[model samples]
Target: MTGTDGLVVGEEVPEFSAPLVAPDADREERSLSELLSDGPVLFCFYTADFSPDCIEEWCSFRDFDWFASTSDVQVVGISKSRSWIHQQFIDYLDLQFPLFSDRDLTIAEAFDVRYRVFGLFERSKRSCFLIDEDRTVRYKWVGQHWLDPTRDVPPVTEIFEGVRNELGAPETETFGFDAAMTD
Candidate 1:
């Protein structure tokens, strides 16, 4: 069930699909169940691509060591940006994770994170969710305001800890940002 404010911990995320931009810049249609099949998934919903805060947030994810170390949990980002924009953002930041293009905000709306900025522009609130293979949300954090540095993104360390605690420790070593660069 959804919380009064939005999706809450323990609720099963609704099924959804979107165009995905892989780190290699390949684009394809991906569904939530398909993603969960690999393992737990972290869905980070940001406003748009290339904005200063967005750049910083994604860079932080790119630099976080835990993400690079883990193979059992997939970290994916979503936003209202188009597939091409997502590709550009990934290439520009050299992001190691896949991103979803929710151009119509359908995914955000399903998660109840869609909101209007200044009562004008429709955008997804900065939010993050850790959903297990069973599709149950284990952790959820939603930002309170737009452009508020204090609330724009959830703490990376906290997300790391949540993933560890919810999905168990990483089972295998994998390439991180540095490895991605050399390849």
Candidate 2:
């Protein structure tokens, strides 16, 4: 049930709920249905927080103008990390999107993105799904391996293109991190 070949476009994603921690530290439980209540979702599942790749990936989304301005698309990040870890990452990156704690891997199992790295370390593989309001996955990207930088990475431009193709929005450009602001 866990691999890149599992889920596919046009499939209705299974439902799941997990604990979510907002940037301000507000904690609550959220479900996929509740998330779609607002609009379509660009759901991303990462391996963990505080990792270099994850830091760049999440920050790219935060810095992307389209991500911030696209009101019709709800952005939610999920990982196996705990709420405290999520809080630290959010604060450190100044992320505007809320992240969910999938500590139990329920959602990852449902999406079939759960996998083990090097055949030992269990974690959520980096994946993304563009789900419509009807719960059908319109687009998806699943990595082939754990920490495979070439495939497991989220290229900002490609992600934005997918977002535009799925949701039809303002154009996007590669979001570069401002080093001065990070300091």
Candidate 3:
């Protein structure tokens, strides 16, 4: 099968590089392998940059504090949108994470999240993958349309909890105030 078919858990992220728009709007090239050099990565592939659902999803990631709670997990957004569009999204949202331009769809295809409808509309599916420092897939989720028959992507807190648990770390209620009960 071609890369379009996607990869499964335990698979190594493909050796691929692409242009990314940093939070500062600086353009740079990054390889999946190179990112692994730092630590585990959360590769979040979404349909379109400015789409409402995508905005909501990513903004949640932006507001979530779990990434800071973990020492080495890097989050990256991927889409077929151009670098300028990615830059615009970052600026508009004041996002803290970097977004990469999957212009060729190579990264999406390798992750098996590329979706094309009737040879017309082509984009990456709303998917998330947690790849460890060794480049092995740790967790993954592919989303369906949020309207009907929703695929129900896991909440940020759940993703954080899972990742933290796997890393052998203590868990905290991400958004809940356990302290309120003690008051």
Candidate models: Cα lDDT each: 0.80, 0.78, 0.74
* Model 3: lowest-lDDT 10 consecutive positions: 145-154
Question: How well does candidate 3 match the true structure in TM-score terms?
Answer: 0.83
Q: What digit string (tens of lDDT, one per residue) describes model 1 on residues 58-97?
A: 9888887667566777899999999999988999988889
**lDDT at 171, model 1:** 38
Q: Over 4 Å off in model 1, which ranges?
A: 1-4, 146-151, 171-183
Model 2 misplacement above 4 A? 145-151, 170-183
Report the Cα lDDT for residue 132, model 1: 90
Q: What local lDDT does model 1 show for residue 105? A: 84
Report the Cα lDDT for candidate 2: 0.78
**Deviation of model 1 at 150, angstroms:** 10
Winning candidate number (lDDT):
1
**Candidates' TM-scores?**
0.87, 0.86, 0.83
Candidate 2 local Cα displacement, residue 128, angstroms: 0.9
Candidate 2 vs 3: which has more lDDT: 2
